[model samples]
Target chain A: MSIPGIRDRKIEDVGLQAGVDRLTEDQIQKTIKKVLKGETGAKLKLYAETCMRCGLCAEGCHYYMSHDKDPSYAPVSKVRQTMWEILRHNGKVSPEFIYGCAQIAYTECNMCKRCAHYCPLGIDIGYIISVVRRICHKLGVVPLYIQDTAHSHSATMNQMWVKDDEWPDALQWQEDEARDEIPNLRIPLEVEGADIFYSVIGPEPKFRTQLIYQAAVLMNETGQSWTMPATPGWDNSDMAMYTGDYEVMGRIKRAHFDTAMRLKVKRIVMGECGHAFRSIYDMGNRWLGWKMHPVRVMHAIEFYHELLEKGQLKIAKTFDTPVTLHDPCNIIRGRGLMDQAREVVKAFCPNFVEMTPNREHNYCCCAGGGVINCGPPFKNVRVEGNKVKAEQLIRTGVPVVIAPCHNCHGGLEDIIHAYKTGQELKFLIDIIYECMEKPDAVE
Target chain B: MNAAYEFVVGPLAWIAGAIFVLGSIYRLVSMYALAVKKDYSSLPYMDLKYSLRSIIHWLNPFGTAGWKASPWTAAVTFIFHICLIITPLFLLGHAVLLETFHGIEWPTISDGLADGLTMLVIAGCIFFIIRRATVDKLKYITSGMDWFVIFLVLATFLTGFAAYHQWLNYQFILILHILAGEAMLASIPFTRLSHMIFWVFIRGYMGSEFGKVRHAKDW
Candidate 1:
């Protein structure tokens, strides 16, 4: 699925190409050998040897479905093209092969883990692809945009490379905007012993500042005790884990957990971003070898569900527009929040029509797993690759799609625009903020 | 020709059995040790409750949505595995041989039933081979080794059937049958056939990761 007249077709990752070119043959060989032998354990051995390659997983992949059943996009075939090739050559593959591996592992597959559900033996192709990413990363071969985001995590302790002072400035802007509405709402900052430590991805400050305003409004209206850190550790979005830079991923997680621990908050409430939730709750903490995170954390979906279930945030009027919920893989499949997401959506927007194959079986946005973060070079493929998802949207026939994850919002927005599906994308918090009643008089 | 037949049925069978048992043991122990030493995270959250639930769902035919979605593949796979295990264990010839060698006795399927099941195994292999070859989506993953494995199983069951029916060259087919069965046995620990043993690790650990770690039902 290439756009015509574009030379930058076929997943042209210049950074990956450059990195592969800079590597000596010996470096590539040794790096692959070292990673394959040292890092992977029985998990890799079990998955590799146990796979029978029945191709049952092809039906589960949006890429395969959208591309007219191309065998190359099958989850196991992606592994064959990468891991099997490395094993076949005993780590002596050419630079061009490594570049191809990086493209397929990093961009083509979303790593959403949906196919794992389809696999009869539950072989995690996502794990194998990540292992390939780990190998490419060690060889300094990675997609340009995602690698740059990981670098930002290293330098700024944030994915967007938001400047130090600008972080709080954005919050101040939101707090003031919210106060104009509430007359007394102040986004609490650095509140010690607060019940909740609210954090968001850097995008809120960089571009989507209105999300911060909406979240602030929700917090005030609910009469919740919450604080946003006026510091670098506030941003929870992570690209390091996606890029297979676990060392940087661990550092970012530490900063986030440490910030919450320092504030003595009872829990950390992250904004609507699926990868950020995954990094903090599932992957980053696991890499740090923490049996449990120092502070309890929940995604915005869980938070909104909790608030709505307890009648803490009451609705003034049910949403008028018909809407469908897009279950982000990290939360629905990775965390089993499918029921809660549906409950929250149905409560506010009663005109809910579920897309076919909803819940854990839903197709990925094709932009997640850092494909969207890979930026404009991959945008065409990202949209075209998930025509199945666009069709899913069209099937729902809803004017709006509510995705509880920021990355899904970004991903779905692009598809809607490109496909001309004419569906507006909104966060769950956005819809709730609109329909939920604010206090009649400010405190 | 007598020497070759005796070698396959006697010494080769013994060698294959020893390797099958010992190699399988070695693989399991090494894999368990590796998990303990390197992948400690995989061990901690393996809740028996979730793991067993996940395993039970996968163990049942049409237990998962994916299995239910593609009924033909699931049916073929389940029947193939069932026949592969049941035919060899319950065949009257195998039971008598075990009783003579190890002084043990167990009820076996009648000769006619074993013949039918053996044909089913061969038919299953043929079905898989044809599916892999003709199905466009399976082309990328259908390796030379996949063909070799399917051919190995087909040859085992095919020759067993021929020797039973006393078809052309009965003595030669009998020898071929013994050798192919033994090759499949020795391959159990070294090749993808090892999946028979490690499904607990791949499917079970995945079950645990999804059910216990991620709190989602993998199946």
Candidate 2:
């Protein structure tokens, strides 16, 4: 049941090359049957049985809309192409079929769950797509870059393969960088029983080390007791969860929680990352058999909101440039931080204008859900799929786009370049750093 | 009564009704019985009040926040469901049938209103069928069962309309109408139409998940 021309687009990436080797038909069938029987439950059955194919979900999907209303891109069509085939064949499908499922589940869909909101039946299409990814993961068929990232998670306990020495070195380096601004500043490393255990994704240390400096300055300015682990658990990002490797997901989450518990922190305050927030607060915790995180988890938005509300962080000047906010889907839709995020933005930027279809209804930056982790090989697909988003940003006519999530920042960076929108993407913290009054300077 | 009428309008009617009730209950119970992991996350936003309010809010197609996302579909669907339910329950002929079978009667709508409502239902079915056939995205996802359900509802309404006007071979048309109605009743729990009962649980669970667990205002 190979889709014509679909295989032609396959990229030659190391992870894809290593992982997606042809499997025996029997192996494929057995794996599919096992997952379908074990993973799927009442909700899956109800969603499958109840969808009326009304196509209302089509309007909600940015991919479908962006792709000229391509039928194959529709959320329900994605389900029919992947999950229904498994059900219809009773898992007797071919390796070719599994490959196609991997592509759709991993590459095409962001698993943002916006379609679930528009569904009259409230079918969580994202969950269904993730189930397909799980099956693909079992079949050893996942996107190259993301699977490689997952391998990093398995080996290094982080996505970027940041080693023990590198983690501490990067922190120390950032601490020195921050001290240039505030002479007495320090990026506290593993201060046990700190009120806040601040974790960040791997990229902060690897490529975006400046973000760590900004966070340090903000923390010092606020006089908040926050310590970052000089270990693997500092990377809150999880590509394994997106790739449907739940075992690796659970392990990564366990290490993260274990790190927090070891530090005896009262709560974990994560940097501005949407999927990481979803992973810690929702998916990863649930996978580890805890109904919730053992320690309270707060996104940077919530933390910022609290700081502002408590008058701990005061804005010395409002951002002069007219700026627009990009609501990261995981935080806005996955958690209800829409109002809080806007309030924080308004505190710094008085000239804040909203993008059309803002908040929970906002379009995904199309980079989260590990799509960006699919990496450079799938760059064109990622950029093309986010045509709607590019248009949405272009419509705002604002120079700067405040994308709070790490992945959204990456995705929007690509979109801005590809679409030639001339829009600069900044994190909320970027503006906060610029506008907040320095505590040492005030005296 | 003729044997044909007796079989369809009498004993078969009771069988359909029984299947409709018991089958629907079985489906609902089995679905709810499916193991669900409890969400132990502390509520950031507790709004059981708004969760219930959202159920009613979503029912009003124009009123909900999602209306902006898919306005036309929402409007058409809202109207279609309203006409579909009202025409069957409050039609003069259906009231008479209910009184004859179960010795129960409710106020009936005027024949003119019932006729207009029936026409609206027919139009809705046609719109659905055409949309499934013509909308590229919809056409791909639509299964035989999807079209079959639409055809089945159309048949019921068409035959009932024909039987009401006494258009050619009244008895035969009436029998076809009853059989079509019975088929719809028997299939409700098994088909996509089961959303009628499942909608409560689905929408309620989603509302609670968003409103309480995730702490998002979905509406």
Candidate 3:
């Protein structure tokens, strides 16, 4: 039996609902108008017109190489197909163009901004793609599951429809479970005026709550002043941002920042996430019209570096397993945190091998940039699109892979399993806490 | 000069220039038609406030305006591209042509700059090709057409520099040089290379549309 047949065996394979899946030419034009209207505002014009396609960006893209060197896979070409065509034709392009734009913006590409590293002109192709996604979202042509996740972001302030009470309850539950590893661990919720506000996405409450517990254990053991919110603002992850639902994205970002402000924290120390960091640092903060983020946001990698650098967190034992780091584009390329992450890894693990072209030039997990969340129908493209990443992992010859960002971790897992890389993937926080001494175990 | 060389170099140059102009006009006109049909409007100035504020971004050491999207890659790639463009146009043979036609002589660079630029272009191309081959998502986007273009460029640059060195010591090397340069010009309008010129207009139009959408202008 073929791979599709095997996949079909796992689920009832009703194909995509026909007719409704495609948009009409007239509808596409209408969507273009609506998108233009919605996207109309201050600060977007600079974003729209700044691209210079030197193709220096070819180096940062995974899809471009993954799909047999299709120029359409290049981030610049993706923009060309949608925004460039719109400019060339002045918006008379068909709905099919919009459909293509939807796929390129939402599914085909991950808005990782790694290409930005190669672009001499520094055209934020990822930003341009996200804008295209925002337009597609307003046009009502986004893939169903991703759009549904965005709806959850709007309604519940979380992507998984996790309620407010469930958020705190999940964190408390994780704290309880962590006590087995280290006795008397407390995952404090809603503490006011804390120095650090640790924010996580909805998955912690919905599926991986133990991560929240792990984070709590690490935070407390490091003796950091941190707190998790007990309200709708707890989730810093924004699927709405990925799905191009700008209005909802604005809401989520606003709530997140407001919650941080309400707590009067020095900065937001986010859990292991890439898109969420991109949202807070790159997208969401900009949507709120701030020149710089009102609340300083740090990924878990940055926070860990800070803790270790200040000698606030001490590693009692070095993790003995050989490991490779999957550089999260947002943290590495966007924020220049790759060196810091490596420093943290070196402090925790005795055996660490750098992936080829690690740091700013790292390959995307192929699932990120909104590709993984696009829906199951596109899974074939997502998995097959990352064969090169699998090959890279195979070459590393390491048993453990540390992916700091949640989205990258999820996406990497899918690719690893699909290609059977036979490696265990863990969050940076997981390994950090595991290797650190308990508060009482200190010398 | 022999009439054949004159015809090939002069009239061919004219034809290449004409084709380049005509092809560019056609692409721009078609693009404009599409934008107009879509009611594409130039973004108002207020929307591009950041782009406006950073006027010197384009003139920076590494094309800072473009690099705002990506600083590190932009710096290195920009430097390499500069060498790629400058080395070809400023080669000794190119200087001879300019001295013959335009009556101007640029100060000759030490062989260091010449060889350095050649190596830079080679390295840049190699880096790009390796990236296209190694990265998964990028591999998906790497089509045969793109590879052909890059490979042709690599061959052109490599062979041109080799011919300059007179390594092969063959008349065919000069012919190859002229042929590659002419072929690159001819291919520009039809291939993705058209993106070089079209992107400006497209970017402007996109900036304007985003302005209209964002209710601001000047991006």
Candidate 4:
């Protein structure tokens, strides 16, 4: 059965056209059986048995609420279609069923775990959907684009596949841009024993090179000792973690941590990305058998919080434009940085108005959980599924929306365009860069 | 006592109690035995005081943060859980039975209070049944097992109410009440009613993980 609401957009855009063509029925069954029987344990059994199917969790799901209360979009329904089906069928489900499971688990649900908060039983539906993704990944039937990104992590140790030479070149280019202002600024490369090793996602170099320049100017103005590795591990983003490619996820996280260890930095401070922070601190590190990161890892929000609290960075002027904050699920809900994020935003923007449901209770931007990585074939679903978020943003009546996470930036951009909300989206750093008083300017 | 009454409230009662105790223990042990992945990330903050506080915060349906999300459902469900527990443990009839069985008696609510509590439980069950039957989202996820448990609780309460007022054949209704109550007990560890035992572990884990590891106020 064809997935409902999937437009005729290019499957090639998602990287699924080539990778999923060779999947056979026998392979699908065997892989599903192997994963469910081998990977799962009593926790899965307990959740399946304990859920009362009360559907009070329906309110917690943005997809279900946005889709006019469509039952299929409910968190439990997502699991019922995927993991519950696998268990009921004893993993002998047909390829068509697997195809549907892939779409529901990957494209339909964001795996944000918001519903788990509403769940009286506290069944982590996100974990259950991820188990389905793992089964699909083992069967080699993942969506095109995300799987391609996973393959990129496997082959290049970074999602963007930035060549070894290109990595340093990008850093040098950013350094040149920062030098134009400071005249003595340097994007410290591989500086051993640095106080901080700054990492960013792949898109930082690929598309948003100016963010690097902005971060460099901030680092230089603060007079903090920091280094950016001109190597494979500089990109902390891991799409493989979302694709259920544990081996690749483990390798990516190991490379990230090992790079920090190599630089001998006291800590690793990552840029404004939610999933990457979750990857290193919550998911990937544990998968690699480290209960915690060997070096302390802090999101840019926390780093900025410390800076402002310590009088390291001063606000020249608060942004006068009415603005609102969009909390990324990984950072706000997955981690507990909502207050710190708000503190940082409040420092720069005086006209800060909160979205109706702010902080940990905020709706996901629909681009997360690798949903945006599924690419254009699923774009309509992503936009329509997050219509509630778009409405929330529109209701805020703020001229600008501050989205701290990269995926939220991308996802909200789409929602603004699709909904014609005429709202501008900005990263917290963008506003900080615009409003902060540079120390060098004092001279 | 008649043969049927003797059988229903005697050996069957002992068997039901045994199953309730052993079954609960077995399920709890099996669940606790499952290996939870250790959180390796060094906590930025740890507050055991707040973790314990979160349990009370979340359990309060009217005052908790989650209450705002689904006020009606939370209110109804909260009342149902309270009545379900209190009516069974502190009701005058159940206390009398306990005294007769083990020669031990605890404080019991007045007969009027017991009747009122039983009425509330029955009303709560009816509200849930209508919700499961009518609400679009709830109807989609509602399973036969869910309805079965609701009706089972309803039957236990309805029969107990009838036996209390002597509205029906007293011995027969009493026997049915004992059977229904016992069946509900036996099903608790195996069915969705297992939440009765697992809620502590699940909510506690969420509290500690969110409160201590993430240093976030979940409530």
List, in order, the clash count of every candidate structure. Answer: 1, 1, 60, 9
Candidate 3 lDDT over B1-219, as tens digits, reads 256556656878778778888887886676555444432222222235434333333435454323554455555666666887788676777788878978998756666678788888877778677866875435543455567667767777777777777878545666666667777777677675655565444344434322332222111
DockQ, per-model, please? 0.73, 0.50, 0.07, 0.42
Full ranking by TM-score: 1, 2, 4, 3
Q: i-RMS values of the candidates, in order?
A: 1.2, 2.7, 9.8, 2.9
- Cα deviation at A57, candidate 2, in Å, is 0.9
Q: Which tens-of-lDDT digit does each residue in B110-216 have in candidate 1?
A: 99999999888888998899899899767767777788788999999999999999999989988889999999999999998998888866777788788866777
- Superposed Cα RMSD, model 2: 2.5
Pitting candidate 2 against candidate 4, the one with the higher lDDT is 2
TM-score of each: 0.97, 0.95, 0.68, 0.94
lDDT of 1: 0.86
Encode model 3's per-residue lDDT on A7-76: one tens digit a residue: 2222111111221256566766676666665454322333344343445465467776786765656777
Per-residue accuracy of model 2 over A1-443 as CA lDDT, tens digit each: 54432455665555544555668778989998888777777667777888777777777888888889887888888888888878878888877667778877877899987776677666778988989999888988887788888999999998888998999999999888777778888889889999999999988899998888888888999999989887778888899999999999999999999999999999999999999999998889878878767789999999999999999999899897989999988898888898999999888888888999888889988888998998887788779988999999999999999999999999999999999999988999999988898876433
Best by lDDT: 1
Candidate 4 lDDT by residue in tens digits, A133-158: 89888877788888878988899888
The per-prediction CA RMSD against the true structure, in angstroms, equals 2.5, 2.5, 9.9, 2.9
lDDT of 1 by residue, A229-341 (tens): 88889989889998889899999999999999999999999888899988888888888888766689898889999998888989988987999988899988888899998
For model 3 chain A, give the 10-residue run with minimal summed lDDT: A1-10
Rank by DockQ, highest first: 1, 2, 4, 3
Best by TM-score: 1
> Which candidate model has the greater lDDT, 3 or 4?
4
* CA displacement after TM-score superposition, residue A191 of candidate 4 (Å): 0.7
